[model samples]
Target chain A: MQAFDHHTPQTLPEALALLAQHDGTARVIAGGTDLMLYMKSGKAEPETIVNIKKLQPLQGISATNAGDLRLGALVTLRELTRSPLVLESYPSVAHAAGFMASEQIRSFATVGGNLCNASPSADLAPPLIARSASAHIVSADGEREIPLEDFFRGPGESALHAGELLQAINIPPPKGNAVYIKHAPRAFMDIAVVGVAARLELAAGRCRTASILLGAVAPTPLRARQAEAALAGQSLTDDIIANAARIASEECAPIDDIRGSAWYRRRMVGVLTRRALTALSNAQPLHAR
Target chain B: MAKILVSLSVNGDPHELYLDTRRTLLDVLRDELGLLGTHRGCDAGDCGACTVHVDGLPMTSCLLLAADYHGAQITTVEGVLDDGKPNSLQQALVEKGGIQCGFCTPGFVMNGLALLSEKPRPTEAETRAWLSGNLCRCTGYVKIVDAVMTAARQSP
Candidate 1:
């Protein structure tokens, strides 16, 4: 790894000030699970590292006044997996957190770093996007909120400014059931070939609203609008689900990669989407098995 | 070039060290503290050979910086046994033929100890999930899983 100055800031304001002072020359380190690897691989080489692990404000999980869930930027994936609120209200989020890299990595990988890494194959992005989450970002000037949908610009890219820090992720309480399913060649310690998250709000045996997000099949975590539209206000019959899944496959622009081929990912996207919708329609947890 | 003063408790002993800010917990353990029992198989977080207990939870020491864990309690594989007596998991591994090349044994033992500490009697699936992070390229993981199950059953 490259040599760099390091500052352990005790406060968020101090961290933000250091980031602002260094601007593009400094990078914030939370868990360093992803950032250290990036630095070792020569993908990232910042002149200074502002360690924010001690910034107390960027920790914990809580409910917002709007009945939404707010997860601190530094909240580890393990905490997400074990949080009672996440387990009960957002099972999909918890399931996604549970299926991340491994127990060891999960203990150190933060939710904010996972989102900020902005990988299309990011495990947390699909579920959070499916739940219509928003990101709370803080900068030296002020703070701003960005919807999860608008947060990702491309793979390994986000809308965060140079000196801005992601404070937390606010996921609105789901009005319906949600499920996340990922297809990895191997079950553990592997990246997803095709991941899908489905949120279904059913009323009187009909789908009132739905949000379907696809990962590892696009430049960014993307919503399958056509598939979601197909399910809205309609009963999720076998045929309807199949059609929606097909539409989701069509919406994805996957590319051939080491993990999987574009064709295989497209095929699995359909399969996983159908499975996710079927599971969410029945109000079953994806990882229950 | 920047070094930070990190105070941490390791294996029931408190020690302070001045290490580079970028030094990982794994490096600090092996290089600085001479805790070589924690193997460094994969520098990246994929492999859990560098697993250690940080505040009673198993974490990949390779992925965490030593500076981030100020005043944290870390337990490595060397701390699993008591008074030279092997922990139940360690004893079970030997009896169940779980020891193969032995390179991955420390990690497997530590992870098993962690699981058993949390769930005294873990189901087979739970055992599998707990060991998912620690990869064993030898013995096909059958004996390892069996050893953990046997150890959990033996737990009081």
Candidate 2:
């Protein structure tokens, strides 16, 4: 890896101040899984690294007063996977966390790092976007909340400013069942070729509301708004689900990469979208399961 | 660049050292402490060759900064064996044909050990998922899975 100075900050304010002082020359290191790889590959050559691992306040899983799930920026994927609240209330998010890298990588890869890294193929994005999650960003000025949907700008990019630090992700309790599914060449540690996250609020055997997010098939994790519109106020029948999946597949603009071809990814999007809907159809309350 | 003081416990032994701020846990283990069992293959996090147990959970040591891990406990492949004797997983791997070229064996062993720590008797699917990150280009993973299963059965 390239040589760089490292600073371990004990507080978020301290970390943000360091970032501000360094004028974005410093990269905040949480898990360092993605950042370290970038540094090693010469993709990132920051002058300094501000380590936020020592900040205890930015850790844990909790429910806020607004009934939203609050996840600290430094909360590792392993912790998220093991959190009963996440598994029970937001199985899609938990499942997405579980499917990330592996048990070992999950132990250190933080959700904040995953989001800030802003890789189009990031496993956490689709799930969070489907759940209508929001990001809590802290900078030298103060904190601001941004919906996860508005967070990503493009590949390897995010809405975070130069000195802003992503504090936590707030996931509003889903109104209905949610499921995250991905089609990777292999089950573990591989990036998704096409990943889908579906949230459906069903009432009296009819879909009252829905949100479908697609990943690895676009510049960023994108909400399949057209497909979501097709599912609203309709029963998830074979034709309806198939049509919705088709719309989702059509909405995505995937690019060919080493992980998969664009054609393969588009095909998998349809397959995964259908599967996610099917899974959501049969899904029971997490506690009962 | 000034070296930072890092105090950490490795395999039950506490040690203090001064290291460059950019040094990774993998570097500290192999270069500073001379614990070369933590093989450094694919310095990137893609490969689990440099996996080690940090605070009882398996993590990619290459992704961790040594200075930031002050007071953290790390267990490497060398720590998995008992007094130079191969652990049950290691023995099972030998018996089950899990070892071929042996470059990836240590990582597999460490990952297997970490898995059993979490799930004492993991199902076949669970075992496969746990060892998925540790790549074994030589054995094709058939024997590695068998070895973990056999080891679990042999334990207790």
Candidate 3:
């Protein structure tokens, strides 16, 4: 790895000031899982690295009085999965957290780093978007909140400005049960070929609202508006699910990569979408493997 | 880049060393501290051969900067011994024919101890999921699974 100056800040203000001074030439590290890889591979060469692990504000997972779940930026994936509040209240979040990486990686991979990495196949974004999670970002100037949906600008790009620190992600309690499924050759440690998350609000045995998102099938994790629209105000029967899944598969634009072919991904998106809906209707936790 | 002063405890021993900012915990351990039990295989995080415990949490030492973990407690494979002897997990692997290329043994033993410490008797599914990252190219992982299962049964 190329050499760089490293600083550990014990407060958010100190971190912000250091980042501001270095500006575009510095990188802030929460968990070094991904950043270390980039550095070792010579893909990233920031003159300075500000380690925020010492900052107290960025190291917790809690629930607010308003029934919102707050996950600090430094909360590792293992912490998320092991939290009783998350496991009981947000099964989708727990499943996605556990599904994305191996136990070792989870111990070191942070939620904020995962979001800030901005991979198209991000396991948390679709579920967080489905749950209406928002990111809390802080800079020397002040703090702001951006809906998780708008947080991503493109692959490896985020809306965060220079010197901005991601404090925590706040999630409104979900309306109903949820499911997140990833299609991959291995159950763990592999990137998603087609990741799908479904959050449904049901009343009177009919769908009141549905949020469907597809990952790794587009440049950005996207909401399948056509499929969401199809499932709205309709009973999820076999016919309805098939139509919705078909629309979802058709909606995404996938690429041909070593992981899979575009045609296979497109087809699997439909299959996984249909399966997710089927599981939701059956009230079963979905697992592809 | 200039050298940075880093302090960390390894195997109940504390040491402060001045190392280049680029020196990873793995390199610092093997070269600076001379704890050679932690293998350096696949410097990338792909292989868990360099697995070590940072505050009781297993991490790929090669991926971690020693400076980032200043004042932290780290336990490499060598530190996992009990009373200067291999622990129950290591004993099981030996009795169950789990060793072939011995190169990955340190990592496997470290990861096994980690899993058993968290859950004395992890279900087969749980064991498989937790240990999936530490790949052993030889043995096809059958004897490893058996060894870990045996250790779980023998553990208190």
Candidate 4:
């Protein structure tokens, strides 16, 4: 780690001012788990390290009376794993949180950090994107919101502009069944080879709507648009699920690395998609159950 | 080098020190504080040999910056002593042959304390998952699992 000045901002305005003061040379830390690694690797050399853990605006897990879940940027992933609200409302999100890193890492890692890091293998992106969650950003000027599906720009990049910080991610109550499955070499503390998220509304043995997202198979966690189109309005029979799985396998472009080969990841994408849909079809979601 | 003032409570003792932002909590404990109980096996967050408790949550001390831990309550391996005696987890590990080379014992005891804090009695699966971060090469996990089970039995 390089020697640098540290600032603990108590308010959103103060945090924004600190970010503006450092311009692009500053980095914001919520949990500082991945930030320290990046700094040690010389990939990030920030003159100012802004700690936002004290900010009141980014510190809770509460939902609105209108049924929207607003997860603060600083809310630890471990909190999400055990939050009764999350388990009762969104089990897939909770399960994904558990599947991420070890208990030690999850105890300090934040949901916003996971999204902002923009790792292709990040577990939260596919579920949040499948739910069509929206992100709220804060800057010196004001606040703005964008869909979580469009939040990641590329590997280790986010859609945030200079001096803008992600405040919270807003998610609406599920109108359909959603599931997330992670394929890893180890049971815990392993990055996924392929992660698949699916949300489908079923009606009279037919799929009324669908949203299928794939992770770790591309530069960004991407929505399998064509495969989603294939599942939409189609009955979730074995043949239909198999076809959608095939389309998903063809849709994603993966790279060969230490975890797995490109061909294996592409193949696992199809397997996980089928598995998630089959699991969703076999049992009712936790909320519905 | 930039210097920052950090206030930390280690083992219930408050210390105010001026430190570089680059220095991690693990370095502060070992070098400046002279508390050698915590071992630094891997600077990266993988090995978990520097596992410590921050605000009742177990985390890798190597991953935390001293500056970022202002006003934080930290518990190192040296801090888990109860009345100058080994805690139940440590005793059970000693009785159950959990230590061979003893390099990873502190980490295991710290992680075990975290598990016991949450649930006095946990299932075998839960105990295994909670200690997944800490790695030991000398004695493969059979005796360590027995130690955790014994500790749970003694406490619960």
- Judged by lDDT, which candidate is best? 1
Q: What are the lDDT scores of the predictions, listed in order?
A: 0.89, 0.87, 0.88, 0.89
What TM-score should be assigned to candidate 3?
Answer: 0.98
RMSD of each: 1.5, 2.0, 1.4, 1.5
> What's the CA error at residue A24 for candidate 1, in Å?
1.8
Candidate 1 residues A41-158, lDDT tens each?
9999988988898888889999989999899999999999899999988888898888888877887889999999999999899989988899999988999998989999999999
What pairs collide in candidate 1?
Answer: none
Q: State the TM-score for model 1.
A: 0.97
lDDT score for residue A94 of model 4: 88
Q: lDDT tens string, model 4, B1-156?
A: 999899999999999998988899999999989999999997888877899999999998988888888999999998988789998889989999999999889988998899898988989898888888888998888899899989998874
Candidate 3 or 1, higher DockQ: 3
Chain B TM-score, all predictions listed: 0.97, 0.96, 0.97, 0.97
- Among all windows of 10 consecutive residues in model 3 chain B, the one with the lowest summed lDDT is B44-53
Candidate 4 chain A has its poorest 10 consecutive residues by lDDT at A280-289
Residues A139-172 of candidate 3 have per-residue lDDT tens digits of 9889999899999888899998888989999999
* Candidate achieving higher TM-score, 1 or 2: 1
Report model 2's TM-score to 2 decimal places: 0.95
lDDT of 2 by residue, B6-69 (tens): 9999999999998888789999999989998898888877778888999988888988889879
